[model samples]
Target: MDVQPGPEREDSHVDSDVSASTPLRVALLGAGVVGGAVARHLTERADDMAARVGAPLALVGIAVRRPGRDRSDLGVDPSLVTTDAEQLVTRADLVVEVIGGIEPARSLILRAMEHGASVVTANKALLAEDGPRLYAAAAEHRVDLYYEAAVAGAIPLLRPLRESLAGDEVRKVLGIVNGTTNYVLDKMDTSGAGFEDAVEQAQALGYAEADPTADVEGFDAAAKAAILASLAFHTRVSGSDVHREGITDVTPADVAAAREMDCVVKLLSICERTDAGVSVRVHPAMIPRSHPLAGVRDAFNAVFVEADAAGQLMFYGRGAGGEPTASAVLGDLVAVARHRVGGGLGPGESSYADLPILPMGDAQTRYYVSLDVADRSGVLAKVAAAFAEHNVSIETVRQRMVPDERDGDRHDVGEATGNSNARANLVIVTHAAPDAALSATVESLRTLDVVRGVNSVMRVEGS
Candidate 1:
C-alpha cells in the first residue's frame, strides 16, 4: 500500500498552489442518477474542491456494471468508464460508492478499503445491513469511511448524530425520513384521497416509484430507523430488528378521523432509548397538526433529535433526490480527500456500547383505535372492560351512531328492543401503554360479541 503525504491548509484569500502534493484520485462505483451527479460535480468543480481540500481531487475512473453505455453526456472521459469494478478500486486513493444494494457494492467497498483506500458511500441499505463489518474493515486498514448521504440526503443528519452530538447523549430521534410515503399520506390528508389514489398521485408527480412497496410497506423507513438507532444509541441495529408497519392500510376514514382531532397521519421512523435498551420502529403515526413534524407537508423530510446537552435539534431539507444526494456524496468526498491529505482518518463506527435492541412489544406508545360496534347499550362498557383486562388505560373516547348499510337496513339507536341495525363508530385514544398490551386489547375486542370490526389502529407520535 502506498502512503500519501498530508497537505497543509493555506489562507482562504490566497490563490494557493497545490502542485507539490499528489492528487487524490477518486473512483466512482456507479453512474446512475446519483452517481452521475457525483461524477459531474467532481469533474466540473474540481478546481474549487481542490482548493478547499488544499489538494487536487481527481476523478480517475468510473465503474459501471454495464459496459459501453453512452455516458459521454456526464462529461467524463469515455476511457475512464469501464465495467470492471474490482480492478478500478485497486489504483485509487479514495472510492465513492453510490451503487446501492448488498452484493457487488459491498464486495467492491471492502476490497477498496483492503487495498489502502478511503471510502465514501451513499449506500443506505448496505450500511443498515452490514455496517459493522465495513466499519471494522476500515478500522483495521486505518482508512476513513464516511457516508453522509446514506440517510436524509442533503439534510446533514447522520453527521450531527455521529460527530456533532458525540459529546451529548441523544435520548430520542423521530423523523419523517421517507418522502414517498410522506407525500402519499399528505395527499390523503389534504385531498381526502384513498390510499391507492394518493399513491397514484405520488407516482404521477414523481414522488413515488412504479413499485412503491419498499417505501409504502415501511421497509425504507425501517432501514433508516435501523441506521439512526445504531448511531444514536451506540448500538448495532439491523433493518430486521426494526418493527415496521406501512401506510397502505391508512384509509380516507382514518384521514378524516385525524382531521377531526387537528392531526395528520405520517409514516414516522422513531428511535429511542429505553430502560431495557434501545427501541426502533417505523409506522404510520398521528401527529398533532400544530407540531413541527405535522406541518412538514409534501415530500420534504425533517428529523427531531432530543439530546441531554443540546436539548432539541431539528434537521430539515429535501430528503431524497439526485442533486441533493450528490451534494452529500461530494461533501463526504471532500472530507475524505482532506483526511488523506492531512494523514488522519475521520470518525469510524462507535458501537463500543453495543446496547441491546429492545423488543417492539415492550415499546411504550399511545394508540388511536377506531372500532365498529353494535349500537346497543353496554357496548362501551364492554370495550372498556376489555382494555382493563389488558391493563391499558383510555385517555379519551368519542362515539357516533351510523345507520347500518348492510342490506339497506335502517337501524336506530332509539328503537329500544326493536329490530334496529344501528352501529356505533367508537374512536378511542389511549394513554401510553406497552405495545403488547395494546395489541392484545385489540385482539380481545375482536372476540367480543358486540364488536363488529377493528376499523383502524395507529400509533400516536409527537406531542
Candidate 2:
C-alpha cells in the first residue's frame, strides 16, 4: 500500500496521450487466497489503478482449474474464469501470476514473455531455482519481469535491494523471513514450550499449515535466502547454494541454554558478502535478546540490511497472507502496466557481479555447545585441548552441576564419568570459526573420555 511508482526507463517511443488512451489487458493465474484478493482488488479499484498507470487496466481473464466454483464473492464474473492457462496468457498484455510452484507457473510465464507480455509473480521457489532462465527470456523478448512479492511478501524488501539500494553497496542481509517459523520460535521463547507445542500453537492460530514441513524444516526460508542473497550480493544464488538447518532439532534445553547466555533462538536467513565471495545460510541460531531481529515476534517478518552508504536499514511488516501478499502482486502489476503505457522496462536481474557462493565449511559463526562431561578437575583442560586441536577459539565456559538444575533428564548418564559418578553440563561458547572446523571440534569432543554426551550444538549469531 505504501508502494511508490518506480522510475521507468529513460527511452520512450509512445506519446503520453496515445499511451494514456490505450487499455492494457490483464490475465491472472490461480484463484486461491492471494488470487481471489487480487481479483477483488482489480475489480473494485479499476478506476484508481487506471488513473495511477496513466491508462485503463482491464481484467481480460482469470485462469482456474475449477471454473464452476463460485467467485462471485470476489466480484469476478464466472465467464472470466477459464481452465486454459496457456490460452489466457497468450491473449493478455500483462500477466499477474499468484499461482505458486514450478511447473505450470513457470511454463505459463515463459509463454507470456514469448507473447511479448510483461509478468509479475509471487513464486519464490521458482525464482530461486530457475530465475536466470526467466531473466534471459524477458531480456530476449524485451518485456519486464517483476517479482516484488517473492522474498518478504508485502514488506517491499526485494525492490529496495534491487532498486532503492541499487546505488549503495550492500554488505550483508540478515532476516527472519518466514512468518510461520517466526511465530513458532517466538511462542517457544515466550511460553517456554517445546518445539512441537509451539508449532501446534502456530497451527491453531492459523499462522502455520497442517503440513508445516516447508516452514518448520527450513526449506521455505532457504529458498527465500537464496533469492535475497542473489539480489543483495549480485550473484547467481540458487536454493542449493544455501546451507539450511531446520527448527525441528531446536529443543527446550537449547532454548533454556540461550536464556543462560542472554540470547534467544530464531530461524535466521543470513546472506553476507565475505572475502571468500558470498555466504548464504538459513538455520536456527541464538541472537542476543537486545538485537532488533529478536524482538520480531509472532507472524511478523523483518529484514536487517547493512550497506556501506546506508549503514543499516531494517524493514519490518507482515510477509504473508492473502491481502498482504496480494498488495505486493498489485504493486508489481501497477509498475509493469505503467511501463507498458509509458514505454521502457523495469529493472531486470542484476547478476553482473557474479560472485561465487562459498561453501558452508567456510562460513564463520559462534557456537553454543552443551556437553555432559565429568565434574572433575582435568575435564575443562581436555575439552579446551579438543578445540585447540581444530584451531577453534573459546569465548566462554560455563560448568553446571547436574544436581543444581531443575531439568532431571540431563544427567541420566550414570557411572560413565569414570569413578567420580558425577556429570557436569559443560556449556561452552566458542568464538567465530569455520563451520566445518566447529563441527569437527564437536565430533572430537564426543570421542573424548571426559565427555559423557554431546547434548546440543547450535550456532550463535548477532553477537
Q: After superposition, how far is residue 409 of candidate 2 from its true place, in Å?
A: 17
Task: Write candidate 1's Cα lDDT for 1-463 as tens digits.
Answer: 1112223223211121224256777888999999999888877777788789888776778899887678876786787888889977877778999989899989999998877888999888898899899999999988888888988889999988999999989999999999999999998988888899889998998889899999999988998889999989899999999999998888898889889988999999999997689989998989999888998888899999999999999999998988999999999988887777777778989987788888889999999999888877788789999999999999999876675655545444333544345677889999999999999999999999889899989899887
lDDT of 1 at 208: 90
Separate clash counts for every candidate: 3, 0
lDDT at position 392, candidate 2: 99
- TM per model? 0.93, 0.93
Deviation in angstroms for 215 in model 1?
0.9
Candidate 1: C-alpha lDDT = 0.86
lDDT of 2 at 348: 92
Error of 2 at 458 (Å): 0.5
Task: Mark the 10 consecutive residues where model 2 has the least summed lDDT.
Answer: 1-10
